[model samples]
Structures are given as structure tokens and as C-alpha cells.
Target: MGREFSHIARRCERAVVTAYRELRDGGRGDLQAFGACTTLYRIHHPEASMTEARRLVAEWIDHHVVRGASSPTDGCDCA
Candidate 1:
């Protein structure tokens, strides 16, 4: 995961973290943000299928953003 994500800059890391937190919150708005990231990933990597992009993002979220089952405010720095 580190190797694949080493290229991400600080801004992107923050955005990914935010997306992971929002998804965990569970609501239509949060889902939209999650979908936006996936959608952007698809647009940027047009050759990649949506499912693959989604899987990659989910893996990234699980590995880096959300490792354990903590409270909604536990892992994220969002207030």
C-alpha cells in the first residue's frame, strides 16, 4: 500500500482520509462524496473499470484510512 500510495501528495491524502470518514458516517451526502472520489478516479484512469477503481479505493481506505472499527470520530481528524 505504501508503494502504491507513496505518490500521493499531502492534499490528496487529506482528501482520501476525509472521504473515508464521510463514507463511514453513512448518509446520502457522504455517499455522494465517496462516489465523487471513485468517479474522479475513474475519470482520471479511464482505462480502469469502475469496479476496479472502487476496489482499489476501498482497499486504500481500509488499509490507510480506516484500519480498525473505532468510533466515527476516532481515526479521523475531522471535526
Candidate 2:
């Protein structure tokens, strides 16, 4: 059961990474994509907690806003 939960968490993490990459690549940064992934977990595994989802979203926002890491094509080179 732990392994299954870990696998789910890993998949969620990957979704975050992919979304970030898309945003960095000059693509849309809407919350829908992020929400879709989280929603999937919620719908598929009702027993799973959303602690990880919340953490990922918070981290994603922090990375894009507070950290000033603009999209890759945003003309800023300051990682």
C-alpha cells in the first residue's frame, strides 16, 4: 500500500514538473492543468490525502512568482 501511494505521489510530482516545463517554454500557465492532475488523484483514490497536492501547488507558485524564475522564453537569463 505504501508503494502504491508512493507511486501516486511520484506521478503527481511528474505532472508538476511537466506543467512547469510547459510554462517555462512559453506555454499557458493556467491552473487547470495542475488542478486536473490533482483532481485525478482525488477521484481515483478517495483514501489518499491531499497534503502532497497542496504542497506541490504551493511550491509551484513560489517557484514561478516569489523566486522570479520567468518562463524560459521570457527573455530573462537569471535562473
Candidate 3:
């Protein structure tokens, strides 16, 4: 059952990623992109509230932004 749950979780993550990419490519702002992703998330999780979806998407984006900003190449001057 755990393996099955893991697979479902991975699929959900991929869906969120795809939503984010589409929103970004469409030139949406951060808040708009997050709102769109939250809507996408809710489609997969009907029981989830808008507030909960927003929180989850915000945290996910914040985590990736922090990780990317802290990467060695982010501000390096290497040629």
C-alpha cells in the first residue's frame, strides 16, 4: 500500500510541476501562477480547500526558489 501511495504522490507532484510550467510559460506573475496551480491541485484533490491548496503551492515554490538561489552557480562570476 505504501508503494502505491508513493506512486500516487509522484504523479500528483508531476501534475503540479506541469501546471507551474504552463503558467510560467504563459507569463503569469507569481501570485497568479500560484493561484492557477492551486486550482489544478484542487482538481486532483477535491477535498482540499483553496487556502490549503495555496499554502501547499506557496511552500513548494518557496522551497525550490530558496534551493535555486543558494546554488553555487546562482551568482558566480565564472567565465
> Whose TM-score is greatest here?
3
Tens-digit lDDT string for candidate 1 (1-79): 1223443444444466556565666664645766776775565567778787677656556666546422232222222
Q: Backbone collision count in every prediction?
A: 0, 0, 0
> What are the lDDT figures for the candidates, one per model?
0.54, 0.46, 0.56
Regarding lDDT, does 2 or 3 come out ahead? 3
Worst 10 residues of 1 by lDDT: 70-79
What would the per-residue lDDT of candidate 3 be over residues 1-79, giving only the tens digit for each residue? 0111122234444466556756777888877877887887788777877887777666545544424322122211112
Candidate 2 C-alpha lDDT tens digits along 1-73? 0111122224444354455445645655556655654565455445556875555455644554446444322
Stretches of model 3 off by over 4 angstroms after superposition? 1-9, 69-79
Model 1 Cα shift for residue 78 (angstroms)? 29
| lDDT of predicted model 1 | 0.54
lDDT of 3: 0.56
In lDDT terms, how accurate is model 2?
0.46
